[model samples]
Target: MAGNSDPLTPRAKLAVTAGKAVAAASRAAGRGSGSVIGGRVALKLDPDLLARLAQNLDCVLVSATNGKTTTTRLIAEALRAAGPVVSNALGANMPAGITSALAGGSDAKFGVIEVDEKYLAGVARDTDPKCIALLNLSRDQLDRAAETRMLAENWREGLAGSKAVVVANADDPLVVWAASSSPNVIWVAAGQMWKDDAWSCPSCGGVMQRPGDDWFCGECGFRRPTPSWALSGDHVLDPHGSAWPIHLQLPGRANKANAASSAAVAAVFGVPPQVALERMYQVQAVAGRYDVVQFEGRDLRLLLAKNPAGWLETFSLIDPPPTPVILSVNARSADGTDTSWLWDVDYTRLTGHPICVVGDRKLDLAVRLEVANQHFQVCENLDQAVQLCPPGRIEVIANYTAFQDLRRRVGN
Candidate 1:
């Protein structure tokens, strides 16, 4: 009864039913965390459920250190114009989440999935995607994993013989190295805001020559490939040498780059550039990302910054000086138990603004801010922290668990 499970085998059907029941029960008990728990249950019953569900559909897997959820939402919106599209709309990227979404939307013919950076190779193999969008990669969740380069090498191995067309960010040396051996590749000159991680070449382990946006290895000559698609601010240059204006409700040049990447992928399936751009403009928020919510009579704009790279890109979106910013950080399990990345963020840029540091690790954030001489005050309570800011247009930036907590409390 999970929207159409007739195509599944009897055993798979039983697993799907049980999973749906669990999800319903969790929601009834007010313990729903999207599809994670339910998907876990389903996969435990039938480990091959995702592969079975993805067999008949044309899937597009999206993976990145940042913007995976937003990018997936953009691509899914673009694909929906053609016909029914199924996606893990909750911003969940693991096997369980993918299974739950595909099972629930069985009747849909297209799947747009956001995959975790570490799980990309395995999930790509299972989904056998028609197109894989490889966004920028940088150091993230260092508490859970040691190396981003190792993951890149794994992805390189994973796509060596894949039949799917890969849309990759050429400015990112790590991304370029990851999809280097992919048989069918379409590169995009999506700007790389964070260059700290890509200072060294992935191929020769030598110093990379980055003289602007163009990068090449000094030792082995692993240079950035010429992009098929390029983004210059809000304008996108397509493979056909045509420029299209991409206007979006979402802020930042990064979002424009995301739209450009989506447009490139959509064009592979005969989706018109105008059509894709039009749909992308309709996405105001993905799950709880970029939502302005009213909580305790205060309107706060929620922004999720999960890692250093994410923080860098998101900080650029904030309206100029004199804006009050609420910075939150949590060292919870889901957020990876390391808070050392806080020191790596360029908090000094926010020296002129009034910042309210609030989260589970508020003290740690305050210490870092104080060390950087940023104008900040420690307010553990989120609501009270917002009150410290100016009256209108407040921006609250939080890490993984803190962001989720704020989104849930705001009732968005």
Candidate 2:
């Protein structure tokens, strides 16, 4: 059911029911159980329906490894603030996912989608986005993907010949160079101190040199532009990292980049920069990445660390704790299933000690945690980690798949 779910989209099924009422009648007669949780797959689509939906709306797509969900959600919210709009309701990215999201919308003037990199060229050709939000690319899922350069090369080719406007991250010099000098491009980034975790020339194997947190160049002199819109001032104001105060909901240096990316794209629709930022600050983080979860009369900060860049950002957070940490990893093919990604993550950014390692892959994490020379308890299960893990002042870092599992198990 999971693999074959993509064919016969919701619209196609409805069309069948319309033609033969008995089909719908039969469904009404049988009620085993359907769905409410998530993960709906319908591979085959009603092409006409998909085309019609695309034809009827002005589109925007946001794609990236780490910040996609939050940035896409933020952009959709900002666009809604400007006027009426629709979104790919769930976190849908593939063609089928996009098709399903459009199936139920009554009529949306503006459509915002979170697109995956592998499928974006096809989607862009079909949807013809008026503008695109291209966030930074980093090494993720080593088992599934080639080097980050391969992904960057594909995107550059896809965009090179397209007519859409672009909103890109300026600090990511490779993506910025690919986006260079398009009149429709408006670069965006954080204040000057926002240095990147990965900066390299995709074309040549050269380490990128940071001229400033907002600008970088390779030894070969491949330079990137300063942002058209930037946020200044430091001390990060909200130190404890539980959450940034009221207005700008998504917290940390990484989220600041996401907010800036969203605001830049919203401006292409004629929303002023200040107005866009004002709206973005009003938006909140989605569940998982930086999504604060309440448990056992205490707060558990949840972050989905699927890649080295994302994990580094989480580990960088100011953990004012009874200090120790709960860390997890996975090599499950479905969950990027290869722990080799651990080698790529710059765990040195993490300070002091990490106390406990949880999840089925605890030993894999222990190997990485050991490099940090921290006190760690490697357990086979998350429940054990929770039992032994101290309640006060703690940080738990889990990958995409484990984040959900942790929420159900130890996080209670």
Candidate 3:
């Protein structure tokens, strides 16, 4: 057993010990990843394990419907220029996962957390982060997250009293509205490609005016906030109008936007702009999002898309007619039980591309593709689907459980 070097109270130490034991037992039984169960046991024993472990450490919370995992990973990497930083690298965002991270990283000088959308406020309140990065918010897991408007309102109410600086996406109307009440804010012009969830103004329920990339409410005069940090191609424009070049191993404009937000958060901790950008370039993959895995004699690049917004972003990262792509979907609990969001994704974009559908919900996806007149083959077995895909590297886009299954299959 690794010695508990954290300066935890006697009760907290006991709780952490119990949690680690449960985690080890779980792994031994091949139950699963055990990250969540371990944290759950610890929290069950000490209810305030997160708060206790977070003491005396600089913490940053990254919350968004789509980019939470990737953004959190980027921020943690950037913070490495300072010293060792602790983060939940397993894509765990709930209280249990967070407790595990804090307890495990108890001796680390800094913390970066990817918080689930609905649980952001509660976690932020407990951790009392030094900075909170608010990325775009859209309708995700509708069965779990009731309404997008309510979530934004909850953020506004929760962050109104916090003294922490908020690094927010100015292009997202929901984010702009949510961060409006924060005492200290640094808005970044991170582009927004998903706007279906924000057609109306949250303040007046009136139609919003979109002239260019900016938005404004005609009735209540609510508008987009000007950003101090902006992205121009791969270069980041700081508040002083100085451009810092950024290069990332991860592909996609979405990741570039993530880099901009992370750089801004790193600045609050005194990390140089170039140093932050250089460190961000080191992140090749987040969880299994961009992992190139070898499975059954085939090389597949895995991409995760759990909702319409995520699908749009993932699709943008791929070439219009790149290697054959596999689209996988599942209605498991991890993926919301509802599969209606499939219709919300613009399948028309893949009109000329070959798509192989796989997953428990392949039939659901097949129907949607047929409706869009997209030619696709449904292969229930992913290995079989890979066999059908074109030679050379192929792209595999999977949602929640399907993505996780593929990662495990490749021994990731």
Indicate the TM-score of model 3.
0.97
Q: Where's the lowest-lDDT run of ten residues in candidate 2?
A: 31-40
**Pairs of residues clashing in candidate 1:** none
Model 2 Cα lDDT, one tens digit per residue, 1-412: 1122234456766643342343234346662111111113322334454455566667888887777878887788778766667776446577756765654544566788888877777787777788888887776777777566667767777777677888887667656755663456767654322224355665465787765453444566666665566534321121122222224767677777676677668767876555666677656557555656665544566667788777777766747544666777766665687787787776655656556787768788788868866567888776566567556545678887687677666443
* Full-model lDDT for every candidate: 0.87, 0.64, 0.88
**Residue 33 in candidate 3, Cα distance off native in Å:** 2.6
Deviation (Å) of 378 in candidate 3? 1.1
TM per prediction: 0.97, 0.81, 0.97
Once model 2 is optimally superposed onto the true structure by TM-score, how far is the C-alpha of residue 166 displaced, in angstroms? 0.5
Alpha-carbon deviation at 401 in model 2, angstroms: 0.6
For model 3, the local distance difference test gives 0.88
Which residue runs of candidate 1 sit more than 4 Å off their true CA positions? 1-7
Q: Rank the candidates by lDDT, best first.
A: 3, 1, 2
Residue 385 lDDT in candidate 1: 86
By TM-score, how accurate is candidate 1? 0.97
User: What is candidate 1's lDDT per residue for 307-405, written digit by digit as tens?
Assistant: 889998888888777888899999999999988988889987786778888889999988888899888888858878877776677789999889988
Off by over 4 Å in 2: 1-43, 181-183, 191-200, 203-207, 214-221, 234-246, 410-412
Error of 1 at 307 (Å): 0.7
